[model samples]
Target: MSNPPELPEFPSPFNFINNVPITLVELRMRNFSGQIREKPRWWEKVHDADIVAKWRSEIIEQDEKVVEQFWGGEKRFDDGNGEKKWPREKITGAQLDYIFDELKDLAQAIDHETGIQRTAIDKVYQSKTLIPADLKTVFLSGVSILESVPPEEQDWHPGANDQVLDLVHPSLHCFRIGRSPVLIPERTSGCPDPLFVLTEEQYLEMREDAEGAIVSQFISTNYQWLPTDFEVSQPGRRLYSNITSILQRFLPLFERVLSDSSDPPPPLAVAANPGGWYEDEESESDLSDDEMDARWRKFHWPVIHDPAPFSPPTQEGRTPLSLNGRKLQVIIKLANIVLTPERPKYPGGSWHVEGMVNEEIVATGIYYYASDNISESKLAFRAAVGDGTDEAGVSWNYEQSDDRGWTVAFGLRQWRSMNQELGSIMATEDKSSLGRGRYSAFSLSTRRGPSSRRATFPAATIVVPRRAGKVPALRALPQEIWDMIMQYALAGTVSLEEAKQDRLALMEERSHFVIEHNREIFEVEFNMCEH
Candidate 1:
């Protein structure tokens, strides 16, 4: 994994497994080889069955322990005064992808499906294909994927020496996510039925996996909160670019950075997110009621002073790309990614991005969509002039319930309005939930036609860190601004000048979270990841 870790979502503790660290990847590649079945009395002559069997179970246990180490949270146990606790995490997308890639190779080399399974975990985690039992045994015995490894690699192959005795199980029981081709870990880690225990040597492998998981978890937990070490690349720079392709379509409403004035407006202010620096510092928090009201005003509409020295948002041909030839620093706190399936009949969709700064809705925006057949773009976006509610006040939004058990504000009314709009688009709604759809949003497809301006749309389809739906790949702003804000947040001190930095850091971390882990609720694997 050459990835320089970016900021993470849910703070440092929750993150993606970028890549198996280079050293470990190479080492494990050697120690985990299975025996070929063609040899006579292969179980006895080629390998020790008893030793293999013992190792097999140990491998599974070790894998589970790794999950526990990084993510386990306390389940309340009865204490005289109150419930006591532990910690937890789930499996991430990167881990799942790694497994899938490895399995693909094993499947090709083995004769029987079970053969591939055995070779993959050889005293590692046990994985059986969901095929029939009678077929399973034959597959296990005949499947020899030794050929799958090139000859040079064969001698170099490593088997989990500690779990060297755990033999491969015959039964397969893997699960898939909907129509997605990827297979995930089974929810239950119950001892594999017909599971054989491990020999002493075989038990060593689990310890290794546990150690690896722990290291990975530690890196994941720390990197997220710590500053990133990334050198700005094309993708990073684009986030700060003046190109506004989608914003331009909405034609000049984007009030980009201001030129001429060296001073940033007072509107810019930074505030620490609760549980950000150190999980809730006090049992009671410190937000004033007036502060909450001010935030409401900002989310509803942009606030400009009566004297208005700085020009307010005006529909000019896309606000100038550069404010004094520089990009403004800001973080887009990406709260959620909703795959909304809206009015199926109309060539339209929208995304409601919401976040608070200084007790104000500094990052509220709706990305609107329409068929840009003339432009040849299927998904162009229309952004509001400011991070506020529409002129009509038709939509409002809020946060869903979370594990912390803390009280938070929600925009159920806004969600209901959004639900109606989407229902009208798709012509479908849960009979029980009525106009309010059963879920927040659903997936949608964008079709581009020849000669059309690549059907552009604002990020209305789902909630993401930045609005990639309408904008091009995000351009990275100068690293100076990002680091400054991150530092301020950690220090538990925020200033107006550091406003943009705060917003940007928050978003950067959120995106990192999404990329590293599955964003969907159903996709998270708590037992396999760090919570």
Candidate 2:
């Protein structure tokens, strides 16, 4: 084989892996520049035996406190003001808030591996034009606060019921619920902020009650801390206004970081996946060709035997194992493929494929292969697909959408259960095309069959008739259709030969541009790998 290309030289001993900074803006690549090491605590040391004895004593004390405050505390208090009347110094709301603040600070410092200063994660996802509206409508649904009253606990806060937890998810930002009504005497330190989001619909359904219940229970009872307002200016008097900003966080990623108690990950080493082991395993499990053919025939019938008067295209194609290299099937999904009558109609003739299902129009999204030019050893794409009524109701599977339904291709190295796949560019060319001012254009799979390098209509999408207004047909390749198909070299779509010509032209233009500004064109990077 050939040598693996070396990573482009970057900076010194503080290299990318364990050192380079990354942020939302520079999410161009996933490879990191650092090591994941266990942080050791120093300076405060004790002998092993002494440490064990101290831990045992602490456990015993905690258990005794639990029992004294919860099980029998009720028998002691007459008016629910907790058992022992501990002073403010013993335990105050201020103390616990400080602990959370410290933890947040420590977490930030620990995760300070930095990158570029691009837009925040939440901002990119919030664009309506970037994501489909239906897909964006995600949030929390319902919330109810439970209060626990361990009578003999501290009067300042008393029982565990006083500890209020606000669980905010997508649709619903804050569901500040007290899990168990029974409260502990002193303040509970870990009132889980495992914020689970609510869907827009569920939030609308239960928002009013959940909000009221949380507010009444927290301020009216225990210590209020978890930033009731964006900034905790007057924590004692802040209301639900702060919920919006605090809720604005990228809840999913934060939740993963904070609450995930995942098992210890398996070590990453070459010995774990030796090549011979996989080969032998596959050899042992080989299936007979005859059996494979029999199974194949089972799926060979025309998807649509007696097609509907206005039939849709067949989207039930499998990854013809005959054509399998890498499971990656990247199709530039456009919005116009949406053919459900509830929303829009197809461009021309009804759906017809090598096989068709007896439906009005081929339901919608069709999956297929890339062009020969895309045969470059490695290439990635930016993609978008329609999430409409066709994908809803019943014809397709259950769908999840955000507030604004525009979709974007994030990484090519993902197994998307949706349209389009993405990755990095290995090598490529480009080209451009022009609309004949009139004839309708349709996109179809142009992958080569096994027989020859010759291409065939392996698949086709049912085009919904688009009324391209004054948006010059050539320029308006319909955001969905022309977005990815544009030949990179030409700045738009073009024939193979034309794309090659464009590549040459771009190289020449770049050469001139660089001569005009040579210093910056070729960056001189320094490295300390060996030096």
What shift in Å separates residue 251 of candidate 2 from its native position after superposition?
A: 23
TM-score of candidate 2 on Cα atoms, chains taken together: 0.14
lDDT: worst 10-residue window of model 1: 428-437
Q: Write down the RMSD of candidate 1 (Cα, Å).
A: 31.5
Name the regions of candidate 1 deviating beyond 4 angstroms: 1-231, 234-239, 242-353, 357-359, 366-440, 443-531
Candidate 2, residues 1-531, lDDT tens digits: the string is 543222222111111111111111112111110000111220122223464345335434543464355324432222122222211112222322332232223333322221111111111111102112222222110011111225442121111122211122111111112211212212223433212223334323432322432222211111111111112334312222222222222222222221111222121111111112111112323668886555443332111011112222232531111111211111111111211223222132211111111001111121111123112222122112222112211322211331011111111111221222212222111101100011121222223332111111111122111211101113333454333333331332244354334434433433443332212111111111111
| TM-score of each model, paired residue for residue | 0.17, 0.14
Prediction 1 global C-alpha lDDT: 0.24
- Candidate 1 backbone clash number: 90
